[model samples]
Target: DVVGLDGAWVNDFAKQGAIADLSALMTEHDYDDSQLASQVEVDGSTYMVPAVNFVYPLYTNDALLADAGVDAPPSNRTEFADAARAITEAGDAAGTAMPLSLETPSGVQNQVMSWLWASGGSMLKDGKPDLTNDGVTETIEYFDDLYQDGVFAPGAFTMKEQDMVEEFTNGRVGMMVDSLAHLTMIRESNPDLKFSISALPAEDGYDGKRGIPYASWGLGVSESSDHKEEAWKLFEFLMSEDANAELASMAKAFPGNVASVPDFVEDDELMSQAFDIYQAGYPANEFTGLPVAEDLMRQMNEQFQAMLEGDITVDDMLETTQESWSAEF
Candidate 1:
């Protein structure tokens, strides 16, 4: 009864024979395979029922931005930096905290990937590391500059995702790149927190486009389960249209069932922004659906965090990561 195995873990679990195939269950329930995100499969077998979908986007505290004289969210990285600087400065004057905050490890990995994707770069070009590309290099450079200039909150190099959300919810940060789950938390905790949402900004001085980092949570039953049939029956019920819509509402996630997808795209402006990014969302895992995909990402993210902390240069980080990914791939 695993509730939420990451989508990236599906492949490794399938390879390890740890999860039962849900393909038959899907057919019996009349679940259209075509409606699912492609990450649900491994070697032509469906191993999990996707329950929640998410995308990472820039969430701004509009009150902080207005206080800093920023009229709108930045369209690109240069403006983002400028706005961050202004907000930081103003926050300083007002005895507040930093304007930008980022998560370490997993969440920071997503943030960095957005920068790469915005510049037409990917960590995996064809199931192998592409860390040495211009997009990756420049993205690291920009983050390094921001860190050195004291743009991001102090200790951001080690903060976890929940830590970042705590900072945002407490009005300590003007902007952050995070998932819809945080939005729900913020609203429930502080309904008056003035905020706006937008796509992640592009690389500094680049006009490529904004990028969204999307991921999912799915249900997987152990292959050794004596009641795999019962487990899959539960999966079917959980992923059913009404159940999915209700779950999405509670979690502030997109329903995995395509038939219930419209429930998330409401008339609200925030929902509109979310829908725009979700429609254009890209998988954070460049080698998604591959064996050890999540492990590879974790390895690279650890190295990337080191780069952010100035423990290693971008070139050295890329070279080391390339070797590790090559060995794994």
Candidate 2:
């Protein structure tokens, strides 16, 4: 049978032998996977094929920025913090939105960890937990400072991604780091909203390429499926250059096939901007393909919330999260 799943869960499925390896099938069918952005491989065996990748970019409310006297979108962390503070002080809206709810802790991956990624920082080093690294430490301090200074929108600890998106659409927040897939929904919900999408702000003086976080719609074949060849046919068709491009365009995401370029950029200005941002960075999602990825994020979310509430220090949070993640590895 055909199996639909998130790219992040591919490794776990493969490890459990729940998914069939597609390497032989792909080779027999002459399928070229070289262009795909991500391949789900376990023990050198291909397990899943990512179809579309939704990249996260910074979304800014132009009117709020202008009201706060900010001249342009921030390119680095220092400027970003200044603009956020100005927006909050101007009483226009909260500087930015953060969804930190533990119930759906993927925000730890999409929102919080994105900051670390953008700055060329990583939670893992040499494929192991390294949460206490200088970069991770600094990143945590920066966000904790923002939360303390009231720069984040209300209910951050209780908010989900949908809630954050709703706040942005309703003009209650001035900025957010979010996926391009939500572009159409935001437009349809608030046709008059004026906003722009840009690359996530990098750490100061970090001139290297930023790491843009992404999620994917991925597919695989069940190990026990009787119709393996039939499933292979469907996968081949969907991943074809033309079909891949069409799928990405409809979903407002970057094509999983690197050679397949979506057409939405030509018709939508924001999407065009998003495309530029996507090209300037590399896809980064360290948690993807890791075992117990969601559980790790949940553990981080718990400690992060505690740190924000003054119940724990940054060091304490880092130590706790590091130990927890190390156990998984």
Candidate 3:
């Protein structure tokens, strides 16, 4: 049986206004926060329940770092580049070394958004989208520098989520930002490898800004599903502190619920090593969630690529960004 449910289908349905709610067809069912995302707000009520939550996280090839003579995880953007440069310069990788491999489409968007957050970008003000600030420009400039300098994998523009993970696992790339769920796969494939996780680094010397792409993966119920009752039962179970912990433990990903991190996971050294990051994590939700105001991030990816590749000037990028988001946001 095919679910026939996805963003493409949803968007098409939304266009024709043909999507229907099946909640009435199914009896009442209960689900937790984990299942919440499968259902979305419809007339102020939930519709479908999700079974699992996927999170975007960073995975580094510590082996590569060591071979390149890097003593520890990069402390800042400069250090990050230095490590990547060292690995590539030492001839570890053929002519290509991806210091940063952004795999998931959503993950790519989040990575760019983090730059805005880290650089004091004002995405929301008084609960509305506000892109009129300096942060957005500053972040775009930074990303432009990264891409123009050839720090990222050339194929990053078209990489699938799983393929990105395989890049790091197969020793092709030095770092990867992908689903936290794959940590288990990585552990199994390379038991002796050293890896670490923490908040993504913000712009260099931006002490006030800490980089985080929260809302990695969350459960939401679908409003069109008939099996909502049974789904909700599973949803609630998934969001349970018990279930969340087990998933986080098994997936090696951070927990969505701030109160529900699993015990099996070790403490985050990145947060411990850097106070700005720790403080950022503490007040991390400053602009949490992809609020309706912020607009869907897919457009951000398109604009960033254009901005980075010289297809559009920075001002052009800004103009297009404003135009793209002006109406909906």
Candidate 4:
């Protein structure tokens, strides 16, 4: 059985004929795709079910905020920077903790792009890379300044998401943005850590609107599977409402089955906020699951890393990114 692959793998797998098209199985089994919040579709065919969807939110260490005399998390980009600086001073953030943890290359890429989207732009528009959008340019400049001002931890460009999570939970980061999947682990790692989750701050004049990147892991059957019928039976059974409810409860993730949602949603403040963000968010990138898209993303990341090291100016980075995109697409 083809299973437990990243959502981005769907398109390439289908192109290689390594995974069977799930459209017929979906219909034959009376599976309703619309009930799920995210679906993996390549061209006109369904390739994977939405097994577990994840979204990122700004996580604030409430204790750190209180120590910094910050009354609340910043609601806009202008205030976000100010808050970072204030926390840095009031809490001796440079020595005690990072005012913010912008995990590099990987998380930093998403962190910046979320800003781009919040500013009403996209990396891809109309089936092509559009990294030169004004919003995108502004986001890069914003981060360039933020990083130069020492808002993020030193050596952050060398840190990954896991590293940021470790710092945040260890009381070494005043704030960080990360996925819900990390929440349970964070709580378990440090139950006494006072933290709160909120949507990413938007640029001033953005009316508090922000964009979240959504991803999911779902099931797919291998084309070479001889026991296709039996494999599907297992897949279908797991996708059932009862099974989904159980799965959601265990994983602390949203279930694909609409009927199973309340099992994880009700009385859960974090999950409820997550659902709201999900309602307002978009897929991380439209180019995802496409062959050349990964290369494009890597090139973008490399440019971003260069910007962090003062090796590339923001304008130069964007110019290079656009050239790469133009060449690729």
C-alpha TM-scores of all predictions: 0.79, 0.93, 0.65, 0.83
Q: Write the per-residue lDDT of candidate 4 for residues 289-315, one digit (tens) a residue.
A: 555545656678778878868998888
lDDT of 2 by residue, 1-329 (tens): 88888866877888888998888788887877787777766656788777888999999999999999998888899999999999999985899989999899989999889988998888876668899999989999999999999999989989999999999999989889988789889999999999988999999999888999998888889999999989888888788889999998887788877778899889878888887887778788888777788999999999999999999999999999999989987
Cα lDDT for residue 98, model 4?
21
The TM-score measured for candidate 2 stands at: 0.93
Stretches of candidate 2 exceeding 4 Å from the true structure: 23-32, 43-45
Number of the top lDDT candidate: 2
Task: Give the worst 10-residue stretch by lDDT in candidate 1.
Answer: 93-102
lDDT of 1 by residue, 18-93 (tens): 8877786667767676655434667677776667778777888888889999999876888888888888888652
Residue 179's lDDT within candidate 3 is 49
Task: Name the candidate, 1 or 2, with the larger TM-score value.
Answer: 2
TM-score of 4: 0.83
lDDT of 2 at 88: 96
| Per-residue C-alpha lDDT of model 3 across residues 273-307, encoded as one tens digit per residue | 32233334532222232333233455656766666
- Winner of 2 and 4 under lDDT: 2
Question: What is each predicted model's overall lDDT from 0 to 1?
Answer: 0.70, 0.88, 0.52, 0.70
Model 3 score (lDDT) = 0.52
